[model samples]
Target chain A: MIRIENVSFKHRATPILSDISLDIPKGGVVALIGPNGAGKSTLLSLVARLQPLQAGVISVDGLPVDTTPSRDLAKVLAILRQDTTIASRLRVRELVGFGRFPHGRGRLTQEDDAIVDAAVAQFDLTDLSDRFIETLSGGQRQRALVAMAFAQDTDYLLLDEPLNNLDMYYARALMRSLRSVADANGKTVVIVLHDINQASAHADRIVAMKSGRIIADGTPGEILTPDMLDTVFGFRMRVETIEGKPFALHQL
Target chain B: MISAVSKPSLWTGLIAGLGLAVLFVLSLAVGVSPLPLNKVLSDPEAMQLLAVSRLPRTFAAVLCGAGLAIAGLIMQTLSRNRFVEPATAGTAQSAELGILLVTLLFPAAALWVKTLVAGGAALVGTSVFLATAHRLPPQQPFLVPLFGIVYGGVIGAVATFAAWQADLLQFLSVWTNGEFSGVLRGRYELLWIAALMVAVAWIVADRLTIMALGREASIGLGIDYARMMQIGLVIVSVITALAVVIVGMIPFVGLAVPNIVSRLMGDNVRGTLGWVAAGGAGLVLACDIAGRLLRYPYEIPVGTVMGVVGGAVFLWLLFRRGGHG
Candidate 1:
C-alpha cells in the first residue's frame, strides 16, 4: 500500500497541493482525473519522490519515502514523467536495458537481459528495438520510454500523462497494456490521465481532483456521473453507459 | 528484441591505433634539428635532444589532446549540449587566470604548484558554469554554447586586462596560444595526471552515459545524479587546467573530436571513449606537425592551426542536418 498523509506543496509561495491525503492499495489500477492545473501531476511527482515533500509523510509498503534511500525506493516504485528527454544516442533496446541499472549497476547479467527482452516484447517494440530513439515517431518513442519503466520490474508504477503525443490507436493500446499489467502481474498502477473515457474504460478506481483537492473518489460507476464531472471539471459533460461501463462524452 | 551491448568494431580500433602510431613517429622525427634514427642512437647530444625535447613534446601533445577530448565529451554529456567545451565553458580561461595570479604572487613557484593552483581555479569556474547551466531551460541547445562563449570571453577579457596592467602581457601570450615549442622534459609532466584522469573517465563511462538521460530518469535509475555531475565537473576542470598549464589552450580538440566520434561510432561511451581519445591525439599531432612545417624553423602555434581547422569543422557541424536546435 502507498499511504500519503497531510501532503501539501507550494511553488515559490503559490500553493499547488493543499492538505491532500489518500490511501492507494496494492495490486489495482487507480486513475487520477482532473482539469488543467488541477495539481494531478504535482501529486504524482510527490508520491514518486521526484519533488521533495514539504508537509507530508509518504510510505510505500511501510518504507518511508522521505527517508528511504533512492536506490531502495527505485526497487519498489518506478515513475515516468511526461517530459523526460534523453540526450544520448541510445537505441530502443539499449534504452530499455538501462532500467536494469539499479539491479546490475551497469553490468547486465543474463537474467537482466531476459527481463529487458521481455519488456521490449511486451511493449510491442521488438521490430523497433534496434532503431535509435531520435528516429522513432512520438508515439513509438513514448512506448520505448514506457518499456524502459516497465523493465524496472517495480511493484508500483506511477505514470504522469503517458498518453500525451499518442494517437488514438496507441492511446487505447497503451491503456489496455497497463490494464493487463496491473491485472496479471498484480502491480499497483497510479496514472494521471487527461482522457476521462480512457480512465473510465480501463481503470478499476477513479479519483477526481480540482484546484489541488480531491473532490470525488470511488469506482468508475460511482464517480462518472454528469453531476460529478461538472463538479470536478467545472463544466457539464454527459455520461453514458456503454456495455455496462460508464463512458464520459466530454468532447461535445 | 535486440541485445543492448554494442561494441565498436575491431577494425575501427585498429585503424585509430595505427594512425596514432604513425603520428607519434612523425612527431618525434620532425623538428627544427632533424635527428636521423642512426645518429640519435649513436650521438649523445642527438639522443638528448630527442629525449629532452622531442619525446616530451610528443607525449604532451598526445596526452593534452586525449585529455581535452575526453573532458569535452564529459562536458557535452553533462550539459546536454554538443557545443560546450573546456575552452568555451570558461574553464581554460579561468585556469589561465590562476596561472597569472601565481606567476605574479610567487614567481619562483614550481611548475606543479602553478598547475595545482590553475586546476583549483578551473574547478571553481566549471562548477559555476554547471550550476548556471542546470538552472537554464534546456529547450534551446544553442543557448548553452552561446552562454559558454560569452562566459569564457568575459573571463578571458579579465585575464587579459590583469596581464596588461601587470606588464605581463608577453608572459600571458605564451599561455594563451598553444605551442609545443616550449615543451621540454620537466615542463610537460603535469599532463600525465590528465592521462590518468582519462583512465578514470573510462572506468566511470557507464555512469556518464546514464547522466545524459537527464536528471529525473537518472534519478529513477537509482543514480546519484548530483554526485555524478560533480565528478564530471571535476574531471573536466582538471583536464582543462592541465592542458592550459602545460601547452596553453588548444581549441576544438575537445569539442570537435567527440562530436565526430559520436557521429561515426554512436554515443555508447564504453564503445566510443577509446576512439575519441585516439581521434583527439591524432588530430592534435597532425596539427602540431602542420604548424612546424608551415614555417620550417619558425613555426606557428598549434593553437592557431587548430582554431582554423576546428572552426571550419564546427561551422560544418552547425549546418549539418538535424545537428543543432
Candidate 2:
C-alpha cells in the first residue's frame, strides 16, 4: 500500500494541496477525479517525487519515498505526467530504452532489450518503434510515453490525464489497457482522469477532490452518485448502472 | 542489422581521412612564412616554424574547436535546449573579465596563472546561470540561454567600458577577438589543457546525457542530477576559458558544429561526441586557412572570420530547422 500522511503543499504563497491524507492499496486502478485546480496532478506529482514534499510523509510499500534512493524508488514506481515534451529527435524504441537505464546504465543487456521489445509489443507500437517520436500522432505519442513507463517495470504507475488529446476510441483503448494490466499483473495504477464515465467504467475505486481537499473516497458504486458528483464538481450529473457497473453520463 | 539510420562506412572513412589530410596540409604549408614541404624538411628555422609556431597554432585550433564543441554539447544537453552553449552562457565573457583582472592586477602574470583566473571566473559565471535558472519556471527552456546572453552582454559591456577608460582598448580588443597569430612557441601550450577536458567529457558522456533529460528523469533513473550538472558545468567552463586564453574567442564554433553533426546523426551522446570533435576541428581549420589566404600579408584574425561565417551559417541553419524557440 502507498500511504500519504497529512500531506500539504504550497506553491510560493498559494496553497495547492492542503492536509491531504489517504491510503491507496495495491493491485487495482484508482482514478483521482476532481475539478480544475483541485490538486489532482499536484498530488500525483508529489507521490512520484517529481516535486519535493513540502510537509508530512509518504511511504511506498513501507519504504519512505523521500529517504529511499531514487534508483530504488524508480524500480518501484514510474510516473508519466501530462504534456511530456522533450526536444530530441529520438526513435520510439530508443526512448523506451532509456527506461532501462537505471538498471543497465545505457549498456543494455539481453534481458533489458527483451523488456523494451515487450513494452513496444504490449503497447501495439511495433510498426512505429523505429519512427521518431515527433512524427507520431498525439495518441501514438501518448502510448509511446506509457510504453516507456511500462518498460521501467515498476509496481506503481502514476499517469496524469493519460487520456488528454486522445480521441474517444483511443481513450477507451488506453483505459482498457490500464485495466487489464492492473488486473493481470497486480500493479497499482493511479491515474488523474477528467472523464467521469471512464473513471466509472475502468476504476476500481474513485477518489474525488475539491479545493485541494479529499471530499469523497470509496468504491465507484458508492461515489458515482449524482449527489457526490454535485458536491465534487458543483454539477448534477446523470448516473446509471450498466453491466454491473455505475456509469456517469456528464456529456451534454 | 545494417540499418539506414547508420552512417555509411565509406562516407565515415572518407570524411575522417579527408579531415585529417586537410588539417595536416594546413599545419605544414600555410602560415606567416609559408614554408614549402622541402624547406620544412631541410631548413632548421623553417623546421622550428613548422614544429613550434605553425604546428602549435594548428594544434591549438583543433584542440580549441574540439573542446568547445564538447562543452557546448554538454551545456545544450543539461539545459535541454538546442541553442545553449558555453559561448552563449556568459562563460567566455566572464573568462575575458578574469583575464582583464589578472592583467590589470599583475602586469606580468604567467600565462597559466591567467588561464586559471579566467577559468575560475567562468565557473562562477556558469554556476550563477544554473542557480538562477533553477528558481524560474521550467516552461521556458530556451530562457536559460537567452538570459545568459543578456547577462553576458551586461558583463561584456562593463569590460569594454573599463578598457576604454584605461586606454587599453586596443590590447583588450585583440585579446577578446580570438586570434591564432600569437600562438607561437611559448604561449600556445595552454590549449593542451582543453584537450584533457574533452577527454574527461568522453569518459562521463553517459551521465551528461542522463542529466540532459531533465532533473526528474535523471533522478528517476537513480542518477544524482545535481552532481552530474556540477561536473558538466565545470567541464564547460574549463574548456571555454582555456580556448579563450589560447586563441581569444572563436564565436559560435561551439554551437554550430555540434548542432550540424547531431542533425545528420542522432542524439546518442557517445556517437555524437566524437563527431562533434571532428566536425569542430575541421570547421576551425578551414576557417583559419581561409583567413590566411584572404588577406595574405595583412591576415584576418581566424576568430573574426569564424564570427562572420558562423553567424550567417548558424542563422541559416536555425531558419532551416524551423527555428528552435
Error at B316, model 2, angstroms = 0.5
Which pairs clash inside model 2?
A: B178-B248, B178-B249
The clash numbers for all candidates, in the given order, read 0, 2
For candidate 1, the lDDT comes to: 0.89
Candidate 2, A109-220: lDDT as tens digits: 9999999999999878898887767778888888888888889888899999999878888788889989988999999999999987899899999999989899999999
Candidate 1 wrong stretches, greater than 4 Å: B1-7, B38-43, B321-325
Positional deviation of residue A27's Cα in model 2 after best superposition, in angstroms: 2.3
Worst 10 residues of 1 chain B by lDDT: B1-10
lDDT by residue (tens digit), candidate 2, B109-152:
98889889989999998888777766766776557767878988
Which pairs clash inside model 1? none
lDDT score for residue B123 of model 1: 89
Error of 2 at A128 (Å): 2.2
TM-score of each: 0.96, 0.92
Best by lDDT: 1
